[model samples]
Every structure is written in structure tokens, then in C-alpha cells.
Target: VKSGAGYLPVDPSYPADRVEFMLADAAPVAAISWSGRELVLPAGLPVVDIDAVDVSEFDGSVVSDADRVAPLRSSNVAYVIYTSGSTGRPKGVQVPHTTVAKLFANTESVYGFDESDVWTMFHSYAFDFSVWELWGPLLYGGTLVVVDYVTSRSPEQFLELLAAERVTVLNQTPSAFYQLAEADRLASESGRAAELSLRWVVFGGEALELRRLSDWYGRRGDFAPTLVNMYGITETTVHVSHRVLDAALVADASASVVGQAISGLQVFVLDTRLAPVPVGVAGEMYVSGVQLARGYLGQAGLTSTRFVANPFNAGEVLYRTGDVASWNSAGDLEYLGRADDQVKIRGFRIEIGEIESAVLADVSVAQTAV
Candidate 1:
């Protein structure tokens, strides 16, 4: 994605037919794949087998500025990420360079990111969470530790990797972090818990259960690896608001407060009529500012429905997040349940309707429900 090309990432686990559908929708210029992976590329799209070429064989020649492809502008499409569709087919979201660039523009002050940090690419490339993991480090001259699919699946192996690599910054879904915290508990009991160098633990992609970290914090304490919970959506880049969690806040039984908006973004809890709801009253969230995506790819109707013109700003637009939230007494936004049936499991957003549709596709199935 850092190159001047806009690419679509496909999960290797996807069925061939599903892959074909995505390829047909995006109509990318070319496809790149690992040499050994069995992939069915679109009929005419060129395939670049990464492992087939040897870089040492080439004379290290640099392209002249005149001959090089022009650098992409901030408005250019950076990537297209597909979201689970309420309809039968998934819809892709076209994210521009400026939207992504804004995610990290002034985040260093809050997160304290620097070249000294060692980050891990823990999530799948197909997931938007991986965008921050992959680029945040490289863009700032920090080392990015890549974990294989197998290691990522096993919490024990993942913890081992984190200790071995001395990863300083860690990002995880609350579900995955729960497993890792359990593994840490087991390791601690056996007197084998590896000493870790993690300085920041950023959680996102799902609603966080603060109590889930009680055991992990019991071992590591509240100082090292400052814990942060971020509330975000793919449509609004990676994150919108961040809450720095401590033991005192975690012990509180009230709703999870997802702290104030990040730099260059505005968040509002509005009623059905787009009017701001009173504090402590639940309402649909509408996010504004530069972080918003251009809109859903090839989904004009859905885009128009969700991305409405900003009433406060003449030329700007706001993204209607189906999530319901309200302002707490502390001025932080507290998460309520989804306004719709969209559910997040293991950090992947799943539309229950989509699951029902897939189940009904079976030949023998007369009817199905999720």
C-alpha cells in the first residue's frame, strides 16, 4: 500500500469462489502471491510471484525521478477493504491516503511512538487492524516483527514470540488478548513466564472487557506496558477515540468509557433526526473530520445512506456508525450495544444476516437463521 498502487488484500483462507468474487469486484491491475500458495488469479491480471525472483541477480539500478511513476496525492486511493455486507455481497470501502495519514499524524504524543519501539504485525492483512500494525512502525523507522499464521493462532506461541522479539508496542483484539493473558497466567504459575519488554498494549477491533486483564495486571502491575483501549471503525480509518486504562478504572463496573476523540476527528451522539442527544442518553454515533473514508466502493445507495452531509459544515460529510453510545459524567463516550445486529467476534465484524445467507446457500437446507 506504501507504493503508488492501490491494492486489495485477500485472505488466504477464503474459498476460491469467494476470492474470485472479490477479484471480480475490485478488478485490480495485478495480483501478487507467495510462490507456493495455490491461488487462482483473475484471467488476464498479471501475477507477481514474490519468491520466484532473485533480487541479487539484478544490477542495483535506481530509477531516475523523470522515469519513475509520479507519487500519489493524499486524495488518491490507498487501499480497498471489504466489509461484511447486509446484502448478500460484501461491500468494499475505499480509504484514501489522507485518511490513513491522519490516523498517526499527531498520535505520537498520546502513544509515545518512536524509532526505538518494536511492533508486531499480529493481525491478518485482510483486516484493517493490521494496517496500523504494519505501517505505524515502518513509517516511523521502527522495527516490525512479522508473525506467521500458525504462531498467531496459538496464544502460547504468540507470547513466546513477544518475549523473544522484545516487542515494545502490542496491538490486539480484546478476545485475543484474553487468551494471551490466560497463557501468561499459566506461565506465571509454572515459574516460566518470559520477561517481556512491552511498553504499550493498545486494544481495538472489539469491545474490551476490562476485567479480563485483571489476572495479567496482577502479574505485571499497572506501570509498565500502559494499557489503552481504542474505539474505531474501518470507515473512520483505524481509531477515533482512545482510553488509557489503569487498575482503578478497570475496577469500575459502569460502562466502558472510550475516551475523547483523537486528533483531527469529531464524534457526536445524535438521535434519529440527527440532533444531539442529551448527555447520558444513548444515540447513534456520527463521526466527522478528515479520518472518514471516501465511501463504500461501488455502493452508491448504501454510501448515500450512511455518509450524510454534515449539517454543521457545508462541504463536509459525516459517517453514520450503527454503534450506540452516550456521554458519561466524566465526558467520555460509553459504549452501549449496537444499534443494529452487526456483531464482532474475534475482532472480525460479522453481519448475522450474511451468515444466514451463506447457510441458506446449502442445497439441502430448506431454511436457516443465524
Candidate 2:
């Protein structure tokens, strides 16, 4: 089971022996289990052995397909992301390298990133957003400042780091951004926010209203940090589109324009028949071209259902995003809602109707809409 450092699992079958070596070599940042007494932790990490701990403490894994390598192979295993399942089992999603690269390149092009800028990583390695904040900066030759989990969780501590680090870029959820914007220190001059050299603030992992965010930042004057709203799902690398923060645009549009498709990516609003819906008509958003995941691990049926052939073109697969959206004449997209009953609350999607149906049936809640 011996292996070199940096040996991470890239696929389901990673020579069990090699993976064992990795598991053995992995230094646990924190460990939690019902049987904490029997568990051993990696060096230099505190033990928070509870019944459960958030997935943030674990290292994120990205695996790639061996045969598919060109264009970075969206099939290439990008991450071994694990999360809680409805049946109380842990489910892992296979993200791909091509997808990650697509997102990184897209953001770089959209934001005009340069080596001089410094971006802070607030999300834990387990979260998909961390991929963008970590690798995006690295690939673009920008500085990446990793903030401690404790500091990230605290409003005061987080702002202090933002100010001290002179972070030019920040990517966080809407809730996280709201907390920072509403902080007493940032709201006042005595707070170091104004003095801090932050430039662009990116928001992802949730939908954000442009007007609300603009109004909040506008109070700080015209030079306030630019806010970028990005739309994406865990399965789709990190992001598919972005909307830059412009006060005039926000005021005029009444909503943030989720910008055009990223490079090497194609977005379409399709009706039930998988036909492209007319412009300005709401339909399921389907993602094609690069940046799409290969398929769900071992779930061929589910994978086949979601990852179907592209009727528009042969030899291509398009991901059924399940998000309802419409395109304006400018080619920008406006998100309407989820095609399914799933509800995105605070940026997380759940099926509430499914939960109620399950409750009435007195069986089990297979899923719930949030």
C-alpha cells in the first residue's frame, strides 16, 4: 500500500492498495464518529469527535478517466465529493478535470484576473466552491490566501483577514456576503473594509438579487468592490455563467443578468421534448459542450436519464440541469425556477413537496424540496 505523496483517488477503482496508502498517509484535520474512542486523527488537528461533523474537514478528491484526456476530459475525475443522502447514506459525486478547468478559464476571462491579484479561500476543501477559489487563483498565477475555518465562521475575524490580506478577490455564498456587508465594522469607517484593498467580490453557491447587493455596496460610495454573481451546480464544475456588479446595469435591468455562456460551454433552454424553447420563454436549462460531468458513479440509469444525447448534434451529451431559464436577445439568461419541484433555499436545493408526499404516505421521505 506504499505510494508517493500527492497520491489521490481519481476513480472508483484506484488500486485499493494505493488508496489504502493514501488513507493511511492522510493526516486528519478533524475526526468525528460515534465511536470516537476507537478513532485516530491525523497530526496537528483538534479532535471534535461528535456523532457527526460537517464534510468541510475532509480533503476533496477529483478523479479522471484514463482514456479521455483531450480538452482535459470533462470525464476526468475532478473530485470525489461526498455528501449526506436522503436514505441517510453518504453519496459521492464524481466531478471532472475538464469541468474544473472550464470554470477556471471562464472566470479568469470574465474577471480579467492577473498575477497581481490575491484571492482568499474561505470555503473548506470539501466544498466544490473551494476548487475555484484554490485552483483558479493558482492556474491564473494569482496569490491564494487560505483562511482558517474558525476565522471564516466568525464575522469579525473574517473581515480582519480580508483587510489584512488585501484580498483582491473573494468568492462566497450570498448569505456569507450579506453577513460581511452588514457587519458593523464594514458599515462604519472605523471598520477596516474601506481601507482593505479588496477589489472584486464573487458570489456563488446561491442565487443573488442584483438590486439588493448593489444597494448595500453602493452606500460605501462608487469605488465599492464589484460583486459578481455566478450560477452553477456541484455537478457542473464550479460555475456556468457570471453577472458582474454594475450599479447602472442593476438599476436598469431590475435583476442581475446571468451573463452569456462560458468559453467551451453551450447553454440552451429546452422544452419537455428537448427542443429549444423560444427566446424569453421559460424552459429547462440544459448544459452542453465542456464543463459537464461524465455521469453519476455506478448509477447508469440515473446517469443515462440526466446525461442524454444531444438531438441538435450527434456524438455529444448534454446535461439536463433541471433549472428553468430564458434567454434574452442579448444571449444572457434569466433564471426562472427549478423545473422539478426542488426548491433552492439559502442556496441549497431540496424537494419540499416530496417530503410532504412521503409524510402522507407514512413511508419514508425519499427527498424533500427546500
TM-score of each: 0.95, 0.73
Q: Where's the lowest-lDDT run of ten residues in candidate 2?
A: 1-10
Q: Rate the local accuracy (lDDT) of all candidates.
A: 0.88, 0.67
Q: Tens digits of per-residue lDDT for model 2 on 310-342? A: 998899998888888888877788887777666
Looking at model 2, residue 97 earns an lDDT score of 65
Estimate the lDDT of model 2. Answer: 0.67
Off by over 4 Å in 1: 54-65, 68-71, 363-367
Candidate number achieving the greatest lDDT relative to the actual structure:
1
Would you give me the overall lDDT of model 1?
A: 0.88
lDDT of 1 at 214: 77
lDDT of 1 at 175: 89
Candidate 1 displacement at residue 46 in angstroms: 0.6
